[model samples]
Target: MAEKKYKKIVLAYSGGLDTSVLIPWLKETYGCEVIAVSGDVGQGTELDGLEEKALKTGASKLYIEDLKKEFVEEYIIPTVKAGAAYENYLLGTSFARPLIAKRIVEIAKKEGADAICHGCTGKGNDQVRFELAIKAFAPQMDVIAPWRFWELNSREKEIAYAEAHNIPLKITKETNYSKDKNLWHLSHEGLDLEDPANEAPVNKPGFLELGVSPEQAPDQPAYVTIHFEKGVPTSVNGEAMDCETVIQTLNKLGGENGCGLLDVVENRLVGMKSRGVYETPGGTILYKAHEKLEEITLDKETQHYKQQLALKFAELVYNGQWYTPLRKAMSAFVDSTQETVTGDVKLKLYKGNIIPASVTSPYSLYSSEMATFDEDDCYEQGDSAGFISLFGLPIKVRAMNDEALAEKTGTHFPSVE
Candidate 1:
């Protein structure tokens, strides 16, 4: 069958090695006018000079949309409120992919492009993430994945192609590690990090981008107080700031202390186990503080049940199911649990550790009077006797039946008194 020709293709441009080469490749291979769209999700300095570069690489134009504010409010807050962490990962790149893809579709529709393209490889989770999002909004739009199709299989080949085409490369052959960075976190994969046995070269240059290593962290502990309003962070250290500002503040504090380094071999949705190192400095502080706040505010049953919901929520986000109905339903359930999640949590950051100094909440369910051993009117000691007896009634009945049967049969049945 003949392939449908694409007249105009919208490419998710990152200005990185793959996408840098993609602008020319898409044009040369498909004979299509390439429109590059880069979503600005707080990837500092990565966006710089993207316009000139895109134009230089055969793209008709570039769209550097500022999606940072929307990214935090729309994606980051709900995930944090839901307490979703995929296998100890903070779901940074997971949730951001959908938002960026959605924006690309919007631009595609506006530009009247025949198709959309991404630089994600066939083996990674981002391919599913980008395409699933595109399918949700613009299912009919033709999608192009150059890495899965192009002859340039490795970074070495892509670098050679760029040089042949007079296209500049940001990274050299010696230090080419696939990385994804946003406001929420910075992730490092490939190189020696691909092997689970090898430890992350945190002390080495280019290994740690966002923060200091634990050994290089400061000797003195830094204290921070974060205020929350209905599961949303409102302030840091008594100063009221916007959510973006709040995150930036915590990122600075947490980065300095080496608080959020995660080195793990996680299950990728592509049916493979991949190793990566993530630095989610500010996000780590917020997640810890938010979870601690819920400890005081949420009831025992609600908290326990919410924890189960959180695990599923993380799975949905990690598996690129963010735009689906199940995720919406789970988010709704998470929001209901967060009504009373209003509080302030003080934490002590000491060299990769987040120690809770104190936690306070207006809606806290913790009762000092009931929990006190000295004297308490809220809880009756006599009631515990009745509660224990009732709770043990089923066990007592089973034991008596066993004992009766044993005696009649001349069999010894030992029971704890």
Candidate 2:
């Protein structure tokens, strides 16, 4: 056993296999008091019996803070409004880690802990996310990452340690898949999914918790109308609701119709690529609806620039830099662009599809009079002659220079082989 390093340590616990074992391991290795902190970010039944389990496993105390509202209003909605989709990932787990870790820091400071410990493996992105948030909030606190230097290197070994400690864990090799759940999404990784060659078991009955496969979805399509107020979704089907209720309603509606299922082999912030499947039922609907609303609301240049900024925003969030200045600045800019983004978007949710049905906004940029093909007083067809000439000037100039060079060298510059 290692010598004592901290007298009291706050753990970002999830009641999972890794954290379940870390409780006893920390006490035995350092003779420290473990205060487990679990942030309730709409994980539903996953929090069952967490208090009993934490105390039974050697934790001095456990704090379960409800962060669902903050998570949706602050983290999830901003990303959704900004359209930050990273290579098809909705960034469910990526953003949740920082929020959970930030709460752990708050609890740590409240309890006057000497250090913070986590169950994140050295190979994954959560370690980076947790530590960065901790550093941002409490730079002086130490982070004890056991996976970086521990004897229990593998999941099998950790199970053995749990068994030796007489701890109860309802996990088996066949069903052991690393998962993260919150209001926004549910992610499944590890197990057979680690092998990219193997297809995701999307159709399996018990594989997906938040949603279903396209084949299992009902044949009839469902339609949902989302209302946005300055880029944030405010209502569903014309029924006004809070942010949390709005997401909950959409998750059920979208899930039943097989709307939001994604399997991606994405690049991780740890300098490696990993495969994972996600069920983002509500988030998927909101993204599509918000995108459709933006189309009719934002000007072409602002919309185009926001799209580019979204990629960088996604990277910052994925890389665990949520507390950074650049992220805040970008969000401010996105909020500015959303000033006129109030609208209603109707969508048809079929099997694995979110098709735009209709969109309307008070500040719509689309002008039917100016864009009509038939005779219209708002626009003149003859103006295109001058517009085309100015637009193609660079191309015309380049071609003229090429022709002159061809004539001088007695060669065919426009020759095609």
lDDT of each: 0.92, 0.92
Q: Please, what are the lDDT tens digits per residue for candidate 2 over residues 1-417? A: 565578999999999999999999999888899999999999999999999999999999999999999998899989998899999899999899999999999999999999999999999999999999999999999899999999999998998899989988878767889999888899999999999999999988799998888888899999999999999888999999998999999999988988899999999888899999999999999999999999989888999999999999999999999999999999999999999999899999999899999999999999998888888897778999999999999888888988899889998787333
Instruction: Give candidate 2 misplaced runs (Cα > 4 Å).
Output: 1-4, 414-417
Clashes of 1: 0
Once model 1 is optimally superposed onto the true structure by TM-score, how far is the C-alpha of residue 51 displaced, in angstroms? 0.5
Error of 1 at 74 (Å): 0.7
Least well predicted 10-residue stretch by lDDT in candidate 1: 1-10
lDDT of 1 by residue, 1-417 (tens): 115678999999999999999888887788989999999999999888989999998999999999999999989999999998999999999999999999999999999999999999889999999999999999999998877877998989999999999998778887899899998899999888888888899999757878899899999999999999999999999999989998888988999999999998999999999999999999999999999999999999999998999999999899899999999998898889889898899999999999999999989888888788797677779989999999999999989988898989988776654
Clash pairs, candidate 2, are none
TM-score for all models, in order of appearance: 0.97, 0.98
